[model samples]
Target chain A: MLKCNNINVKNILCDVSFEVKRGSFTSIIGKNGSGKTTLANCIASQRKYGGSISLGNTSMLDISPCDRARIMAYLPQSLPSPNISVYDLVTLGRSPHTSLGAKLNKSDIESIDNALAVTGMTMLSNRMVPSLSGGEKQRAFLAMTLAQNTDILLLDEPTAHMDMHVAAEFTELLNRLGKTLIVIMHDLSLAIKYADNVLILDSGKQIFFGSKKDLLVTDTIEKNFNVRKIENDGEIIFTV
Target chain B: MKKLIIIFTPLLCISIILGCAFGSADIMQLIGNDTDTALIIILNLRLPRVIAAVLCGIGLSVSGVLLQCVTGNTLAAPNIIGVNSGAGFCCIVMLTFFPKASVLLQIGAFAGAFITTLVIVGIASHINAFRGTVILAGIAITAVLNACISFLSLLDSDVLTAYNAFSVGGLAGIRMSQLYVPAIIITGCLLCSLILSRRIQLLCLGDAIAASLGVSISKLRIACIILASASAAAVVSFAGLLGFVGLVVPHMARRISGERTSKLLITSSMIGAILVILADLFGRIILAPTEIPVGIIMALIGAPFFFILLFKRRGDNAEM
Candidate 1:
């Protein structure tokens, strides 16, 4: 389990408290400036925060970065395309587990291969990262995070630049990973459809945190996201 | 790539042999008749110059590779980014103030280059450390340092000839003794660079991804800057602001070796050594008895190549 209590990130997030259960896919939904990304960064320990975040019994702040990386992986929204091959890039995920010279052992190679297979990037593993299209690049990064072999995954706007088909495919992959995942999602319908649980942030404050069904019934989403109405014909839809 | 290395290694060896044999004193003439004069010329004069050029080449190019990786700009080089100028300026100041204290010159040069690098990085860090910002900051620093150098030239006309010689950069009068300290420093730094190659490669992915992969970005950046500046400063202390070997050699290496940092580092050092030796050979032979400075020769070759590269890949600053 990943827990955050009274987490405050200066100027971006404040007084946020939440607990993410193991094997749950939680999507953080909010407006553009609602501090969703900040919350994700704070939890990942990428950004400085006031309160406590713990994985099981250990405090996150107390762990070294390399040791912390072995337990959790965080992928940012966008990255400059590195000139290295996809295989080499994904193998970087093994860095935390490797020694000073970054010599990969047998287990590291197995995990790297597993990550490539899981992401369906085995065919394109030899291609240069800079040559990949947007969706492929995103998948490549996702493979790297998966190769980290961490219990918790924090992804910020993972589907922002991806097309609809690719986004759906990626969401399916995430669902099957079975790790504790905290995703910052911009698309309301996608979040509603894919998330096992939902956390709603409204201008740096945690407005709601509960099961996805409870999130849909509450007025919090409508108020926070400026949704005037939500209806279901064949599927649930929101009109903003 | 392997084929290119195979070809280039032999070419480098030939260049070094030719460079050693055909200086002002003819090695062939003194070889059969008087071995002593031949031995002295070959061992004391030509050999050290050749070795110094090769070492300086390796040092500057490795420094360039590190700077380029950390700054994420192909255009980031020791000469262009104010490292060489800063070192040269500090050496001038030291030489002027403490004329007899030769040890202070090298120390001053390293300190100056390191500090100037810090300033450039500091400015770039505040505003995202983008390519354009780093290049502009470098240009500004270079201009300021050049002005200081000119002022120093006017203040002490007696040191003007020595200053001019150093500034132009040559291997004409170097001895075996002069190369010992720089050779040690360069070798040590090169070893460190090779050890850190994996981490440096991670840096090419940009800050966030590198940090996520357990790299301490700030610490790595500082280490890179220190290593780069120290190497460049050491070279400048002996070679006098040799230009473009750092800028051009890494690019040449990349074309042959791809983007793997370890491979790139090794190949770049080799290519760097070759380029400087060849440049020095041309500098010696072109004017015959009156030698051109290797710095001028490098700029003359490097500037045109740099311009062609810039134009050929106009918009893709990140890749080149």
Candidate 2:
């Protein structure tokens, strides 16, 4: 389990506290500039914040970088495609486990292979990253994070640039990963469908944090996202 | 990549042999005659000049690779990005102020290079370190350093000829003793760069990703800049302001070896060494005893190649 106590990130996020249960799919949703990405960065230890974050028994600040990397894997929103093969890119995910010489052992190679298999990128492993399409590139990066074999994954707007079908497929893949995941997402409907719990931020403050069912009944989403819910054909839908 | 290395290693050997043997003296006579003049020319003049050329080539190209990787800009070279000019300008200033102190000249050159790098980095950081912004800041710094160089030349008319020779970039009269410190420094820096190659590859993925992968981006970038500046300063202190080797050699190596930093670093060094030796040989032979400066020859070749690369890449992203 991950716990944040009164986390304040610069001037963007203030007095934010939340708990993310182990093996739960939690989606953080908010408007643009609502500090969702900032909060994600803070949780991943990529950014400095006030207050404390602990992973199980260890404080996040006290964890060594390599140890932190082995525990948590983070994928940024958008990264330019480096001119490297997918195999090499995924192998980079095993960097924390490698020795000073950076040569991969048998276990490292097996992990990379498993990551490639899981992400369905084994066939494209030899292809250069820059040559891959948008969704394929995202999967390649995802494969890299998977190769890291971390217990918790923090993804900042992972599917923002992906097509609807690809996004749905990616969400399904994440749901089946069985790891603790905190995803910052903009698509509310997708969040509603995929997330077990929701954390809503409005102008840097957490207005709501609970089960998705509880979030649906709260006025926080309507007030913060400026969207209204409507009933259509016995199904509930939200529109701005 | 291995094939390129195999092909280029022999070519480099041949170039080194020709560079040392065919310059202003008959190789057979120098070997057979055993006269003091011939011996001195071969041992003291020709050998050191070839060594200097090789070292400068390796140093500049490695510096170029590091700078390009850190900035994520293919156009970021020591020459074009003001590091070379900055060092050269300070060397000239040292000559003007302390004309007799040869040791101080290298120190001045390194100081200038380091300060100029800090300035360029400062400007780049403020502007978010975008490719265009970094290159623009580099160009601006280069212009300013060039102006400073011109001013120094005007201040001390006595230093003009020496400054002109050094600024044109050549291995014409370098002594064997001058190569020792720079050789040690460059070799050390290159080794460090090789060890850091994996981290550099991670850096190419961008800052956030690199950080998430257990790299401290700020520390790595600072180390890269220091290593690059030091290598460039070593070259500029000795070879004057040799341009284009840094700019073109790494790209050529990348095209042949792909983007792996380890392979790229080794190939770039080999290719850079070969290029400088060939350029020096061409400079010595094309005009006979008159001998064009290697820097001029490189610019003559490099300027056109740089323009071609720019034109070919124009349709791509403007960030380059």
- Best by the lDDT measure: 2
Model 2: per-residue Cα lDDT over A1-240, one tens digit each = 999999998779989888999999999998999999999889988878999999987899999887888989999898777777999899999977875555788999999999999999999999988889888998999999999999999999889999889998998888988999999998887787788899988889888889988987777777777888776785556689
Regions of candidate 2 where Cα sits further than 4 Å from its true position: A217-240, B26-43, B80-82, B103-108, B111-148
Best by TM-score: 1
- lDDT per residue for candidate 1 within B71-140, as digits (tens), equals 8888788877788788878878877888898767667777787788888878877876444676788899
Model 1 clash pairs?
none
Model 1 collision count = 0
Q: In angstroms, how far off is B289's CA in candidate 1?
A: 1.4
lDDT at residue B214 of model 2 (Cα atoms): 85
How well does model 2 score by local distance difference test?
A: 0.85
Model 2 misses residue A37 by how many Å?
A: 1.3
Fnat per predicted structure, each in turn: 0.49, 0.49
